[model samples]
Target: MPPPPQKEPPRSFTARWAALKNIPPFLVMVWRAAPHLTIATMVLRAIGAFVPVAILWIAKLILDEVVRLAALPDTPDGLAGWWHSGLADHLITLVALELGIGIASDIIGRLLRLVDSLLQERLVIDLSMRLMDHAAALDLEDFEDAGFQDKLERARRQAAGRMSLMGTIFEQLQDSLTIATLGAGLIVYNPWLILILLVGLIPAFLAEAHFNARSYNLDFRRTAERRETDYLRQTAASAETAKEIKIFDLHRFLSGRYLDLSRKFYAEARRIAQARAAWGALFSALGSLAYYAAYAWIVVQTLTGDLSIGDLTFLAGSFMRVKGIIERLLSSFGSTAAQALYLEDLFDFFREVPEIASRPDAIPVPRPIRQGFVFENVGFRYPNTEKWAVRGLSFTLHAGETLALVGENGAGKTTLVKLLARLYDPDEGRILLDGRDLRDYDLDDLRAAIGVIFQDFVRYAMTAADNIAVGRIEAREDRGRIEAAAHSALADQVIARLPAGYDQMVGKRFVQGVDLSGGEWQKLAIARAYMRDAQVLILDEPTAALDARSEFEVFQRFRELMAGRTAVLISHRFSSVRMADRILVLHLGRIEAQGTHVELLDQPGRYRELFELQAAGYR
Candidate 1:
């Protein structure tokens, strides 16, 4: 799937088969899905092979009768004898047989094609469904990497075209089989003629091989360009880009860019088309010359009476039927092999390296969680970063506690919260849950047991209640819980103010939806986070967008609303930080001081200095 500047795959016999072997499973998978249709196509082809022989046989009969009548003497009885004895009737019968064979061949061919189309459609549908299912199953982290995305894009692209390639391959197989059978019939009549036809095809076969190689090489080299073209199309056509495009009045701008890439694609295709046209013309002429040579030799033998007209006709018929079969078989062989490598790319994704691999199976219970979740000796650096974002950090909270993480920007507060929420597993040390390692629980279970209200929470372009309902997908429609959660977070007022209340949509991007103010959205996010009814909740600046009154009111009811829950608060607001039962002041990725707000205010530390600075501003 990685489209890049590249050379050709091996065009030799051995390499072609090797490539075919690489994707045997995919070929086998499709083959298995429609075995009856496959077998029927092959059988139809085998039957159609005899149609050419029937025509040849009939032609020879007609030729023999005409020759007999021409050889008659000039006497009255001799002239009329051949005509009277049903010689014309015999010729008419031959003509009728030829026409019948032609009609039967056409019918069978159409039927086979119809079956091929249906079979390919079914297989493609299954392939696309499986790919979508697998993509959804992959962990959230894999989507972050760039290399993975390239392969995924390629896989998706190929899936659409793969069905067509596969069907063509099967069709080619049928063509080859039919040609071979007809060739065998020709051998029984005149073996030398088959050799002459094969010799005539050698130049064409070689030329086609060269062209196919060049075509694939061109495709391999322009992968990145193709991706850029896809991006350009999306930018030009998508609704998301419509606003900017209309504001800038940039129709020509996008159209010109699209045309530029399209012309480049067209230029490459034109080059290949021209080469094929020239080669095809040359081969066609060669084939015509070869056929005339064979025809002349057959006529000469017929004149000398050394060969029957029947044998000559059969030779001519089979010669044309079999010439391109070898090329087709070779092309199909190549395609079947290349499909293997694509399937390999798809299967490789299933091999996962879990982000957290060393945890025990037994999860520790929070039975009471009186001395709430604790972070002890916890240190974490991002996967490829040199510096720790949060290092050797330690803090503790009790149930019903709202402890604020106070720090300057980039002082590791958000990183600490993410670590506690287990969005990431610490590179060193562990997160202790009620004096035990947090890694014991199943990853899904652990994540489901907590709620997070991010400052940058997504504003869904869906109905207001559905946005909150996404919190617990398995739960029944609990209108009561949904309403209560909204009321507590002060989002009920936002909904009530809307024309349609809870059923109203919340974004302009979707139908019948209106965008909300920053403060309204903040309250919605908070309500959504607490909607799941989890035991522990982490709010990373949940009220940052709210007005002074909303912020004060939420914090005032914070204790009553969050009772019996272990809640951790993150904020830059001095008033909110001062009210936490315990305040942990962080500096340079570690806790510099921890105490109640008044106790921290008494100390000459990072917290006290920040508090004094804020107090002076207020005065």
Candidate 2:
């Protein structure tokens, strides 16, 4: 709930340049994504770039010929005379060439767009895949951090939208080529004209770059605000929260919250946009002024007999085209530079390496967990917090024994389970598995040996069988195993009553989905642990929602089902806790007492008080 972390300062020149450097690699990524389509798009664009210049030149020639024909006196004949004069032949050829170039340009344009779209689509899929893979590899702590969530949100946007950058680069290149060819023609007439046009564009280009950077900075500063806006919108409208929203009459509250955040974002956007528009209009006038100045000079030269009508038309046409291309090139360059800053987010997320990675030469977890787990003065506090969630916790779970942890709410029971599973390494002390440092074992192999189901387990909107199969996802298709696990967890009876049996959808997120009662959902979730077939099983209050009778039945079979495996059961229900071989009482992150239920009752400590308190409620 803390405020979002501040973004880094506006990119320095070195950082901006580094961002620009990523463009080449991004282009390389695009090429690798769809090499054939990329090459084809570029080849077509290269062909189309010069088509405009060719057409313009041909039009000039046709105009000059028509003027010459008009000057000649008419022959004795009428229409036939004009056709037979041989002057018409050259005119006809020029017209035909212009028409052909125009047609070819249209065709090439469409083909180029088609190829670009295809390339963009492929790159989107490729980039999204890489994003998901990289995110999956990140540590759990990263996902829990708000700053990292903001980065992920930004990266997701880039994944969906940044593929168009490839097309932008190609278009910029094509426009530059067009400008070069047209400028060559104008330079022959008057090099000063080309220089004037270039000068006119400099102000506009600089203004655009400045505004683009401002916009980028604005967006960077508002990452937290944007995420809040998204969350508010989702809460107001999403299926998951809709029931509560209606029950609490929270529609207006959520709507007001959403509007507040959106208005701030809109105000900031409006300010930046208005400034950009004002500067854009002013700079655009400069370019227009420069163009007209060149126009007057061309007309003066024509009137003084220094230039022909044909030369005047061609020079003016080339100058206009050159001016437009320069404008487009500069605008695209600014846009590309701004987009490169966004690329920093995408690349930065990739640059983050997990701090909890295993050592290169780490050993694998013991197959049977011989000596079980040992916590040697372990202590941990989450990142960015002062208080330890669990501190000075030293305990051992003997192999093949079932240990129960009893504690009040917020006693750090869940934190202990997470530590045991290596979801987090201790900040202060080391944990050992079979006497080897837990960090010394292969991370994946070590996790695969443990199965944990927490109280807030997800109820996936999937088939009933798929829900349970999540525990051992690799064996999801094994029907016999799925049923066996389900039966062991007392969920098979609930599934059997479903309309489609094992294939029945279990949550209301999708159509035709059936919502289950609290106890029934807990049964499906508990089945996951049975499916995992792991050496260590930790049930962290997964049975909390079950009825008392159901709870008694589950615990009655718990020991029999988990005969040889090491187990840890964390629950508030003393009936369940007392059934364990031994009980450890946790209070404020430290074990206040440890012994069997009978021994703890005799000690007259925190455990006895808590037990008597629960017993009084029943009496």
Candidate 3:
């Protein structure tokens, strides 16, 4: 049965205000991303903030001069007469000064936007790099956990989506400065006007804050559904899933599921939007009434001869500017808070520390391992699972010998190999290397010394040479080593068929990429194992896609390559299993028997029964 949709809980007003705590850290990140740009933006905004008042004040001076000249007893009859009388000189100078300030204001605005664009791009790049580095440092187990994935998705989205928050913050700072200057001018005429402005706009500000909280809550609750919809959309059209989707005729099903989820999202968003628009209209009307009230008071004072005409003009203009600036400041404050909520997700992800990091003063892995690994009463279970994948397992892999593990599906063979590589620490007991616990060695050095190619390896969309070099990425530039490894794994033949050989792009993900057959991809995967010159090598069903003849040839080459190094091979084919110096038959996560092929086949046990079953298939 499908799970019920999650409910969107209302975020508290206090919670919204608390999100403000994230702003300091967020600004710190912005500063670190581009310090020079940040400083430039602030300096420009500070200069531009006072331009409006300067323009308004100049207009007042020009108006007062016009009135003085018009009331002259012997006023000039025309423009030529006025210029000759020197009457229009003060008015003309005021107009020219205002024009200059206006132009400078525009230049400053343009510069601010240019700096902001560059700064935003820098911030995104820095955030993405940090996210990648932190994710790389995390444990493999963390990626496998479902909760961690959701946090990761949210963090990834915030890294790019929060660029607008930076601009909003800068605008708020500029608007606040404008408000202070305008409010001071209005206060000189009548301090009551400031009171009227706040009374009218506070309701609208509260309404904006309330609705913004709802919007954030709605988005937060639907993160999982959003991820599901994205997956469905990708699956319905992507190249990797196209063949299977067509074979299963799943396009309609996928589209229908996506539509259903999308409709639900639309319905919820529409509800909040409708409410916001209604309240916004009502509160906007109140704000307009407040501005007019202040205007009426200014006119009354002018008519009573308590103030001059120029005073009325200045006071009215100041009141209107203050009202508009205050409205925007309140609205932007709410928006900034909402964006800060998302910043919490990004910072929270950065706070996540890896649980499996190497201890301080850890020793490096021993070279030319004199003694191989020993697993003593080891047991493990996957996270959030009750059943153990492997338990009570004990074994020794001696140095300079090839060990083959033969088992059916769910026999814990792959789990055992992961433990050997220390991709995961055992939940119980210990795995020792050269008489010391595996945890005592440096994690990176230990992994560097062991080469492992799992069954479900990644098929990177890269050049053919890069595919093999991934096994030992430090040797990526060594073309000779890459070619030798490919030859050893019989992948050279596959690469030679491509138009560009080793330099040819593989995988269908990119344009001009050449796709390979399943067997050919497996051969490339096997080559990665040979690329690493490690003390221990493990191949987990590396040739499962190859034909019997090809598998036989690959295993022959594999045996030759294991000369003085410890190796572990896993294969279902009895032909390859019989070649190992010793084989361990596993059942239900336990070692059922261990011996040479002839010895195991002679015994009347599970190994003989499984071998006979495969033999019967040939009949």
lDDT of each: 0.72, 0.87, 0.89
* Collision count for each candidate, in order: 4, 0, 0
Clashing pairs in 3: none
Tell me the tens digit of each residue's lDDT in model 1 across 300-351. Answer: 8878987766666665555655655554554454444455444444544434
State candidate 2's TM-score. 0.93
The candidate that achieves the highest TM-score relative to the unseen native structure: 3
lDDT of 2: 0.87
- State the RMSD for candidate 3: 2.7
Model 2 misplaced regions, further than 4 Å? 1-5, 11-18, 68-87
Q: lDDT tens digits, residues 1-619, model 2?
A: 3445656835564555456877998998898899999899889988988987898888788888888888877642676766777658888888888888889989998888888889998999999999999887788889988889989998998888787788899999889888888888888888999889878898999788777887888888888889998889878888778889989999999889889888888998899899999999999999999999999999999999998788888888888888888888888888888889888888888888988877999898988788988898989877778778889999898999889998888788999998988888899888888999999999888888999989999988999999999999999889999999899999998998999999999788789999898899999988998999899989999689998889888877677767999999998888888878889899888998899989999987988998889899998
- Candidate 3, residue 359: Cα displacement in angstroms equals 0.7
Q: Estimate, for each residue in 233-312, the C-alpha lDDT of model 3 and write its tens digit.
A: 99999988999999999999999999999999999999999999999999999998988888898999999999877777
When summed lDDT is taken over every stretch of 10 residues in candidate 2, the lowest stretch is 9-18
In model 3, state the lDDT of residue 495.
97
Better of 2 and 3 by lDDT: 3
Cα deviation of 229, candidate 2, in Å: 1.4
lDDT ranking, high to low: 3, 2, 1
* Candidate 3 steric clashes: 0
Candidate 2, pairs of clashing residues: none
Which regions in candidate 3 have their CA more than 4 angstroms from the true location? 1-10, 76-85
